[model samples]
Target: MISHVLIAIISVLLVAAYLAAVLAGNPVYSALSMGIAFFLTALLFVLLGAPFLAAVQVIIYVGAMLVLFLFIVMMFDLNKSSLTPVRFKPSTILSYFLIMLVLLTGFFVARSVVRMPSGFAITGFGSARNIGFNLMHYYLLPFELASFVLLVGVFGAIAFIKNRRGT
Candidate 1:
Protein backbone atom coordinates (compact mmCIF):
# COMPACT_ATOMS: atom_id res chain seq x y z
CA MET A 1 0.00 0.00 0.00
CA ILE A 2 2.69 2.45 1.02
CA SER A 3 4.87 1.32 -1.85
CA HIS A 4 2.11 1.97 -4.36
CA VAL A 5 1.46 5.40 -2.89
CA LEU A 6 5.13 6.30 -2.97
CA ILE A 7 5.44 5.11 -6.55
CA ALA A 8 2.40 7.10 -7.61
CA ILE A 9 3.67 10.28 -5.96
CA ILE A 10 7.18 9.98 -7.37
CA SER A 11 5.90 9.04 -10.83
CA VAL A 12 3.57 12.02 -10.94
CA LEU A 13 6.34 14.38 -9.79
CA LEU A 14 8.78 13.02 -12.38
CA VAL A 15 6.21 13.31 -15.20
CA ALA A 16 5.42 16.86 -14.16
CA ALA A 17 9.13 17.76 -14.15
CA TYR A 18 9.59 16.15 -17.59
CA LEU A 19 6.62 18.05 -19.01
CA ALA A 20 7.89 21.30 -17.56
CA ALA A 21 11.34 20.56 -18.97
CA VAL A 22 9.94 19.95 -22.45
CA LEU A 23 7.75 23.05 -22.38
CA ALA A 24 10.24 25.46 -20.78
CA GLY A 25 11.95 28.07 -22.92
CA ASN A 26 15.30 27.74 -21.12
CA PRO A 27 17.56 24.83 -22.10
CA VAL A 28 19.31 24.79 -18.70
CA TYR A 29 16.02 24.27 -16.93
CA SER A 30 15.23 21.46 -19.32
CA ALA A 31 18.51 19.72 -18.53
CA LEU A 32 17.99 20.14 -14.80
CA SER A 33 14.48 18.75 -15.04
CA MET A 34 15.79 15.82 -17.07
CA GLY A 35 18.31 15.11 -14.31
CA ILE A 36 15.54 15.09 -11.75
CA ALA A 37 13.55 12.68 -13.90
CA PHE A 38 16.57 10.37 -14.20
CA PHE A 39 17.12 10.33 -10.42
CA LEU A 40 13.44 9.61 -9.87
CA THR A 41 13.65 6.76 -12.34
CA ALA A 42 16.48 5.26 -10.28
CA LEU A 43 14.18 5.35 -7.27
CA LEU A 44 11.46 3.73 -9.37
CA PHE A 45 13.87 0.94 -10.30
CA VAL A 46 14.60 0.38 -6.60
CA LEU A 47 10.86 0.23 -5.88
CA LEU A 48 10.50 -2.36 -8.63
CA GLY A 49 13.09 -4.55 -6.84
CA ALA A 50 15.97 -4.04 -9.26
CA PRO A 51 18.85 -2.64 -7.16
CA PHE A 52 21.44 -3.33 -9.84
CA LEU A 53 19.37 -1.56 -12.45
CA ALA A 54 18.82 1.35 -10.05
CA ALA A 55 22.56 1.73 -9.47
CA VAL A 56 23.25 1.54 -13.20
CA GLN A 57 20.50 4.12 -13.81
CA VAL A 58 22.12 6.47 -11.30
CA ILE A 59 25.67 5.95 -12.60
CA ILE A 60 24.84 6.11 -16.31
CA TYR A 61 21.84 8.40 -16.59
CA VAL A 62 22.24 10.78 -13.67
CA GLY A 63 25.97 10.68 -13.03
CA ALA A 64 27.40 10.48 -16.54
CA MET A 65 24.79 11.78 -19.00
CA LEU A 66 23.36 14.57 -16.88
CA VAL A 67 26.84 15.73 -15.93
CA LEU A 68 27.77 15.86 -19.61
CA PHE A 69 24.60 17.77 -20.46
CA LEU A 70 25.19 20.25 -17.64
CA PHE A 71 28.78 20.80 -18.74
CA ILE A 72 27.71 21.26 -22.37
CA VAL A 73 25.00 23.70 -21.39
CA MET A 74 27.41 25.66 -19.21
CA MET A 75 30.15 25.66 -21.85
CA PHE A 76 27.74 26.86 -24.58
CA ASP A 77 26.54 29.74 -22.36
CA LEU A 78 23.75 30.67 -24.81
CA ASN A 79 22.32 34.12 -24.59
CA LYS A 80 18.59 34.20 -25.18
CA SER A 81 18.80 37.85 -26.28
CA SER A 82 21.13 36.99 -29.17
CA LEU A 83 19.21 33.97 -30.44
CA THR A 84 16.30 34.22 -32.88
CA PRO A 85 13.00 32.91 -31.54
CA VAL A 86 11.90 29.78 -33.32
CA ARG A 87 8.36 29.67 -34.61
CA PHE A 88 6.39 26.59 -35.57
CA LYS A 89 5.50 26.19 -39.22
CA PRO A 90 2.44 24.42 -40.67
CA SER A 91 4.68 21.56 -41.82
CA THR A 92 6.06 21.12 -38.28
CA ILE A 93 2.51 20.98 -36.94
CA LEU A 94 1.48 18.43 -39.56
CA SER A 95 4.54 16.26 -38.86
CA TYR A 96 3.91 16.31 -35.10
CA PHE A 97 0.27 15.34 -35.65
CA LEU A 98 1.30 12.44 -37.90
CA ILE A 99 3.88 11.25 -35.35
CA MET A 100 1.29 11.34 -32.56
CA LEU A 101 -1.17 9.40 -34.71
CA VAL A 102 1.44 6.75 -35.45
CA LEU A 103 2.38 6.47 -31.77
CA LEU A 104 -1.23 6.08 -30.73
CA THR A 105 -1.78 3.44 -33.39
CA GLY A 106 1.29 1.53 -32.23
CA PHE A 107 0.21 1.71 -28.57
CA PHE A 108 -3.23 0.30 -29.40
CA VAL A 109 -1.70 -2.45 -31.53
CA ALA A 110 0.71 -3.41 -28.73
CA ARG A 111 -2.09 -3.43 -26.13
CA SER A 112 -3.18 -6.85 -27.43
CA VAL A 113 0.21 -8.42 -26.63
CA VAL A 114 0.33 -10.97 -23.83
CA ARG A 115 1.21 -9.61 -20.40
CA MET A 116 3.15 -11.55 -17.80
CA PRO A 117 2.93 -10.99 -14.06
CA SER A 118 6.17 -10.97 -12.07
CA GLY A 119 6.40 -14.01 -9.87
CA PHE A 120 7.17 -13.97 -6.16
CA ALA A 121 10.27 -12.14 -5.04
CA ILE A 122 13.46 -13.97 -5.83
CA THR A 123 17.11 -13.06 -5.28
CA GLY A 124 18.98 -11.58 -8.21
CA PHE A 125 20.79 -13.92 -10.60
CA GLY A 126 24.40 -12.90 -9.91
CA SER A 127 26.54 -10.81 -7.62
CA ALA A 128 27.95 -7.48 -8.83
CA ARG A 129 31.31 -9.17 -9.64
CA ASN A 130 29.55 -11.86 -11.69
CA ILE A 131 27.52 -9.27 -13.58
CA GLY A 132 30.71 -7.27 -14.26
CA PHE A 133 32.40 -10.40 -15.61
CA ASN A 134 29.46 -11.10 -17.95
CA LEU A 135 29.35 -7.52 -19.19
CA MET A 136 33.14 -7.46 -19.83
CA HIS A 137 33.08 -10.88 -21.48
CA TYR A 138 29.84 -11.01 -23.47
CA TYR A 139 28.83 -7.38 -23.95
CA LEU A 140 32.28 -5.93 -24.39
CA LEU A 141 31.76 -4.44 -27.82
CA PRO A 142 28.65 -2.49 -26.84
CA PHE A 143 30.36 -1.34 -23.64
CA GLU A 144 33.40 -0.18 -25.60
CA LEU A 145 31.14 1.63 -28.05
CA ALA A 146 29.40 3.43 -25.21
CA SER A 147 32.77 4.46 -23.78
CA PHE A 148 33.83 5.71 -27.23
CA VAL A 149 30.67 7.79 -27.47
CA LEU A 150 31.43 9.41 -24.10
CA LEU A 151 34.99 10.14 -25.20
CA VAL A 152 33.72 11.70 -28.44
CA GLY A 153 31.28 13.87 -26.52
CA VAL A 154 34.05 15.09 -24.20
CA PHE A 155 36.37 15.92 -27.11
CA GLY A 156 33.48 17.51 -29.01
CA ALA A 157 32.77 19.79 -26.06
CA ILE A 158 36.42 20.74 -25.75
CA ALA A 159 36.67 21.38 -29.51
CA PHE A 160 33.55 23.52 -29.48
CA ILE A 161 34.81 25.62 -26.57
CA LYS A 162 38.25 25.91 -28.17
CA ASN A 163 36.76 27.04 -31.49
CA ARG A 164 34.65 29.61 -29.69
CA ARG A 165 37.72 30.93 -27.88
CA GLY A 166 39.71 31.11 -31.14
CA THR A 167 36.89 32.95 -32.89
Candidate 2:
Protein backbone atom coordinates (compact mmCIF):
# COMPACT_ATOMS: atom_id res chain seq x y z
CA MET A 1 0.00 0.00 0.00
CA ILE A 2 2.36 2.64 1.29
CA SER A 3 5.26 1.07 -0.53
CA HIS A 4 3.37 1.21 -3.80
CA VAL A 5 2.47 4.83 -3.21
CA LEU A 6 6.06 5.69 -2.48
CA ILE A 7 7.17 3.92 -5.65
CA ALA A 8 4.65 5.87 -7.68
CA ILE A 9 5.79 9.16 -6.22
CA ILE A 10 9.43 8.37 -6.82
CA SER A 11 8.68 7.24 -10.35
CA VAL A 12 6.89 10.49 -11.09
CA LEU A 13 9.75 12.48 -9.64
CA LEU A 14 12.28 10.55 -11.70
CA VAL A 15 10.37 11.20 -14.91
CA ALA A 16 9.93 14.88 -14.10
CA ALA A 17 13.62 15.28 -13.36
CA TYR A 18 14.63 13.62 -16.61
CA LEU A 19 12.16 15.73 -18.56
CA ALA A 20 13.57 18.84 -16.99
CA ALA A 21 17.07 17.73 -17.83
CA VAL A 22 16.09 17.30 -21.45
CA LEU A 23 14.06 20.50 -21.76
CA ALA A 24 16.19 22.96 -19.82
CA GLY A 25 17.78 25.68 -21.95
CA ASN A 26 20.63 26.34 -19.52
CA PRO A 27 23.35 23.67 -19.49
CA VAL A 28 23.95 23.94 -15.73
CA TYR A 29 20.27 23.51 -14.95
CA SER A 30 20.13 20.56 -17.35
CA ALA A 31 23.08 18.92 -15.55
CA LEU A 32 21.50 19.57 -12.16
CA SER A 33 18.23 18.05 -13.34
CA MET A 34 20.10 15.01 -14.61
CA GLY A 35 21.73 14.67 -11.19
CA ILE A 36 18.33 14.77 -9.55
CA ALA A 37 17.11 12.11 -11.98
CA PHE A 38 20.12 9.93 -11.16
CA PHE A 39 19.55 10.29 -7.42
CA LEU A 40 15.91 9.36 -7.77
CA THR A 41 16.90 6.36 -9.86
CA ALA A 42 19.23 5.30 -7.04
CA LEU A 43 16.36 5.65 -4.59
CA LEU A 44 14.25 3.46 -6.84
CA PHE A 45 16.98 0.83 -6.88
CA VAL A 46 17.08 0.87 -3.07
CA LEU A 47 13.32 0.42 -2.92
CA LEU A 48 13.65 -2.52 -5.32
CA GLY A 49 16.01 -4.27 -2.87
CA ALA A 50 19.16 -3.48 -4.83
CA PRO A 51 21.20 -1.50 -2.35
CA PHE A 52 24.45 -2.33 -4.10
CA LEU A 53 23.13 -0.95 -7.40
CA ALA A 54 21.76 2.09 -5.62
CA ALA A 55 25.15 2.78 -4.01
CA VAL A 56 26.94 2.34 -7.32
CA GLN A 57 24.45 4.60 -9.05
CA VAL A 58 24.95 7.33 -6.49
CA ILE A 59 28.73 7.00 -6.23
CA ILE A 60 29.65 6.45 -9.86
CA TYR A 61 26.96 8.32 -11.78
CA VAL A 62 25.40 10.95 -9.55
CA GLY A 63 28.59 11.81 -7.69
CA ALA A 64 31.41 11.44 -10.19
CA MET A 65 29.75 11.74 -13.62
CA LEU A 66 27.56 14.74 -12.81
CA VAL A 67 30.50 16.59 -11.28
CA LEU A 68 32.56 15.88 -14.39
CA PHE A 69 29.75 17.09 -16.65
CA LEU A 70 29.33 20.24 -14.55
CA PHE A 71 33.06 20.88 -14.70
CA ILE A 72 33.12 20.53 -18.48
CA VAL A 73 30.09 22.76 -18.87
CA MET A 74 31.68 25.39 -16.67
CA MET A 75 34.99 25.19 -18.52
CA PHE A 76 33.36 26.15 -21.79
CA ASP A 77 32.82 29.84 -22.51
CA LEU A 78 29.14 30.23 -23.35
CA ASN A 79 28.29 33.58 -24.92
CA LYS A 80 25.20 35.02 -23.28
CA SER A 81 24.92 37.62 -26.01
CA SER A 82 24.61 34.95 -28.69
CA LEU A 83 21.97 32.99 -26.79
CA THR A 84 18.44 33.15 -28.13
CA PRO A 85 15.09 32.06 -26.71
CA VAL A 86 14.01 28.51 -27.53
CA ARG A 87 11.41 28.23 -30.25
CA PHE A 88 9.17 25.51 -31.63
CA LYS A 89 11.60 24.02 -34.08
CA PRO A 90 10.99 20.95 -36.21
CA SER A 91 13.87 19.09 -34.56
CA THR A 92 12.48 19.85 -31.14
CA ILE A 93 9.09 18.50 -32.18
CA LEU A 94 10.72 15.39 -33.63
CA SER A 95 12.71 14.85 -30.45
CA TYR A 96 9.59 15.07 -28.34
CA PHE A 97 7.84 12.60 -30.63
CA LEU A 98 10.77 10.22 -30.37
CA ILE A 99 10.80 10.49 -26.60
CA MET A 100 7.11 9.57 -26.43
CA LEU A 101 7.67 6.70 -28.81
CA VAL A 102 10.48 5.31 -26.68
CA LEU A 103 8.48 5.68 -23.50
CA LEU A 104 5.54 3.81 -24.96
CA THR A 105 7.80 1.10 -26.30
CA GLY A 106 9.46 0.66 -22.93
CA PHE A 107 6.14 0.49 -21.14
CA PHE A 108 4.94 -2.22 -23.51
CA VAL A 109 8.17 -4.18 -23.18
CA ALA A 110 8.12 -4.06 -19.37
CA ARG A 111 4.41 -4.73 -18.90
CA SER A 112 4.99 -8.46 -18.55
CA VAL A 113 7.39 -8.05 -15.64
CA VAL A 114 4.66 -6.80 -13.32
CA ARG A 115 3.83 -10.36 -12.27
CA MET A 116 6.45 -12.82 -11.10
CA PRO A 117 6.23 -16.60 -11.26
CA SER A 118 5.34 -18.35 -8.04
CA GLY A 119 8.43 -20.58 -8.21
CA PHE A 120 10.79 -17.65 -8.73
CA ALA A 121 12.73 -16.42 -5.70
CA ILE A 122 14.47 -13.06 -5.56
CA THR A 123 16.85 -13.52 -2.65
CA GLY A 124 20.33 -12.01 -3.19
CA PHE A 125 19.43 -11.20 -6.76
CA GLY A 126 21.02 -7.75 -6.80
CA SER A 127 23.76 -8.42 -4.28
CA ALA A 128 27.29 -7.19 -4.95
CA ARG A 129 28.63 -10.75 -4.96
CA ASN A 130 26.15 -11.88 -7.59
CA ILE A 131 26.77 -8.76 -9.70
CA GLY A 132 30.53 -9.21 -9.52
CA PHE A 133 30.27 -12.87 -10.40
CA ASN A 134 28.06 -12.16 -13.41
CA LEU A 135 30.23 -9.27 -14.57
CA MET A 136 33.45 -11.27 -14.31
CA HIS A 137 32.09 -14.48 -15.76
CA TYR A 138 29.16 -14.22 -18.16
CA TYR A 139 29.08 -10.52 -19.12
CA LEU A 140 32.80 -9.76 -19.15
CA LEU A 141 32.96 -9.01 -22.87
CA PRO A 142 30.01 -6.62 -22.84
CA PHE A 143 31.33 -4.96 -19.70
CA GLU A 144 34.71 -4.38 -21.30
CA LEU A 145 33.03 -3.11 -24.44
CA ALA A 146 31.03 -0.58 -22.43
CA SER A 147 34.19 0.64 -20.71
CA PHE A 148 35.90 1.04 -24.06
CA VAL A 149 32.94 2.98 -25.37
CA LEU A 150 33.12 5.33 -22.38
CA LEU A 151 36.84 5.77 -22.97
CA VAL A 152 36.17 6.68 -26.58
CA GLY A 153 33.52 9.16 -25.48
CA VAL A 154 35.97 10.86 -23.10
CA PHE A 155 38.58 11.17 -25.84
CA GLY A 156 35.98 12.47 -28.25
CA ALA A 157 34.93 15.15 -25.79
CA ILE A 158 38.57 16.19 -25.29
CA ALA A 159 39.08 16.36 -29.04
CA PHE A 160 35.95 18.46 -29.44
CA ILE A 161 37.17 20.92 -26.82
CA LYS A 162 40.57 21.13 -28.45
CA ASN A 163 38.98 21.75 -31.84
CA ARG A 164 36.78 24.46 -30.37
CA ARG A 165 39.87 26.16 -28.90
CA GLY A 166 41.63 25.99 -32.35
CA THR A 167 44.57 24.26 -30.70
Question: Each candidate's lDDT (Cα)?
Answer: 0.76, 0.82
Task: Report the lDDT tens digits of candidate 1 across residue range 60-147.
Answer: 9889888888888888869868567777999989999999998687446434442223431233543355567788999999999999
**Candidate 2, residue 20: lDDT:** 98
- Expressed as tens digits, the lDDT of each residue in 7-113 for candidate 2 is 79789988899899999988988999999999889867866867679889999998899999999899999778757777999999999999999868745644543
Best by TM-score: 2
Q: Estimate each model's TM-score.
A: 0.55, 0.62
Q: How many steric clashes between backbone atoms does each model show? A: 0, 0
- Pull out the clashing pairs in model 2: none
Model 2: lDDT equals 0.82
Ten contiguous residues minimizing lDDT sum, candidate 2: 113-122
